[model samples]
Target: MKKLRVGSVLLAGIVAAGAAWAHGGATGIVKERMDAMSDIGGQMKAVGRMLRAGSYDPALVSSAGATIAGHAGKTLVDLFPEGSLEAPTEASPAIWTDRAKFRAYSDELQEAARAMKQLADRGADMQEVAGAFASLGGTCKTCHEAFRIKK
Candidate 1:
């Protein structure tokens, strides 16, 4: 019975290690997309801080908005070509399977970012800026919920 227990424990350890490796480090296109998404997240956080602080820097907002928009639309969808889901990717297979829906989300992201940038360019007041920022955040949440796999 003791030998049997030891064998079961060893088997469990091996299974757990393999499961962990199933989500291990990505390379190639997967790595590139991860890096790009990280930059977008960082910019979003920076702009979010400015919004929350009520500092209202239109120039800074415009720059960050541009950065986010640059990653939006086709630029984003192109990053995940068919079968690009190497290891360590939290990207859902649904992205490729439901390609059109993913494209729509990407479009929404681009439009929201562009609108926010436009607001900044026009020197909108803080309330208007906040609204635009919120819209951008919503768009991100929508895409992430649908396309980013929970890890």
Candidate 2:
């Protein structure tokens, strides 16, 4: 189909673009943050899948929450040193310009993740864990919306 061919080409172009800028090739703070953010996204997805399945494992959720909370706020900001937006960075200039707001989003993420971790640690039910997870995801969504460049 003509439409399918056009869509496939577009997909390949996007894949090739990211491969060209492979995060490994990017050295310094850019790579560090890229890896860290990738880990965060992975952990979030793992926990999200568990929560969605309704067969959640509390310990695993707690562990993922700890990992996310550990990298929130200051941990995130420290990785983004001045002018670290070289290549393979989703960061936007708006982050540096609106540093306070960005920091707030980081803090929000930490708070939400910590809350979720606490609930999971206490052997809370799926409902409680899901609520906290939603809060944490909200912070991520909010931060990405404002700071991340759609690549």
Candidate 3:
């Protein structure tokens, strides 16, 4: 379980790094989504750092989760208009071709973040909160594998 959790966190870190890299030279809506993704990555890194340092701050974790939730779901979907694949966008065309699946992934991410926020807000144990964080990271990895284009 510990190994699995560590792998999940590493996968999310890679995906977030890719997202940050893809934002370079992006413009318009493409830039918007990239910027949002970068923000999410920043939040993930912060939480990951706290977790690694054994500094379990429930309030900070909850706030990070809430911020991720706000940027996910419909907001995420709206950022990707059909054929908006401008230069530097790491969004795969599969997003438009498989719209429903893309939306489902976005919704899943939002749900996972919300669950994490709830767990943190309730003062869950470190293991419980970390599990929620791992679950959220897994969702991000899965979605990126399916919908993101590697640069």
Candidate 4:
């Protein structure tokens, strides 16, 4: 009986290990996305502070806004799909479990990004673009509050 129990335990460990390996894991991809997102976050914050300080050149805002919209709209959601947040993901599990709400915030961010880019591309007066900028910032804040874990 003792030998049989030991064999059973070893068999269970082997099966668990196989299951884990079959999943293919989330090590490098998660790290890469996290770094990419962190870099974009830094860029977003820098642009916000620069604009708020009344020191940003309009051209810089245009370029940076394009850069931000590009990544935020594309890469952000690509990194947070249902199974994509398995491990090493700073994303909250709520992203998948409460998928509708997660997706709503993601869509909001994408829309804000598109709007920001359109406003920037139009070469609108900075004052006229202020509200759009605020909307863009607000979208990011709303999503962060709901889905992203604070580091």
Each prediction's RMSD over C-alphas, in Å, is 15.1, 8.9, 3.0, 19.6
Model 1 off-target regions past 4 Å? 1-24
Encode model 3's per-residue lDDT on 55-124: one tens digit a residue.
Answer: 6799988999999999999999999999998888888999988999999999999999999999999888
Which should have the higher lDDT, number 1 or number 4?
1
Query: What lDDT does candidate 3 reach at residue 99?
Result: 95
User: How well is each residue in 1-151 modelled by candidate 2, as lDDT tens digits?
Assistant: 1122123233333233334333567778888888787777777777766654557699988998899889888999888776678866879988888999988998998888899999999988777777787667778778888998977
Clashes of 1: 0
Model 1 gets an lDDT of 0.76
**Candidate achieving the largest lDDT:** 3
Deviation from native of the Cα of residue 39 in model 1, angstroms: 1.0
Query: Over the stretch 47-151, how does candidate 1's per-residue lDDT look in tens digits?
Result: 766665567789888988899899989999999999777777989999989999999999998898889889999988767776787777778778888998867
Clashing pairs in 1: none
Candidate 4 lDDT: 0.59
Clashing pairs in 2: none
**Best candidate, TM-score-wise?**
3
Candidate 3 lDDT score relative to the true structure: 0.84
Q: Look at candidate 4 and tell me the lDDT of residue 83.
A: 70
Q: Which is the winner by TM-score between candidate 2 and candidate 3?
A: 3
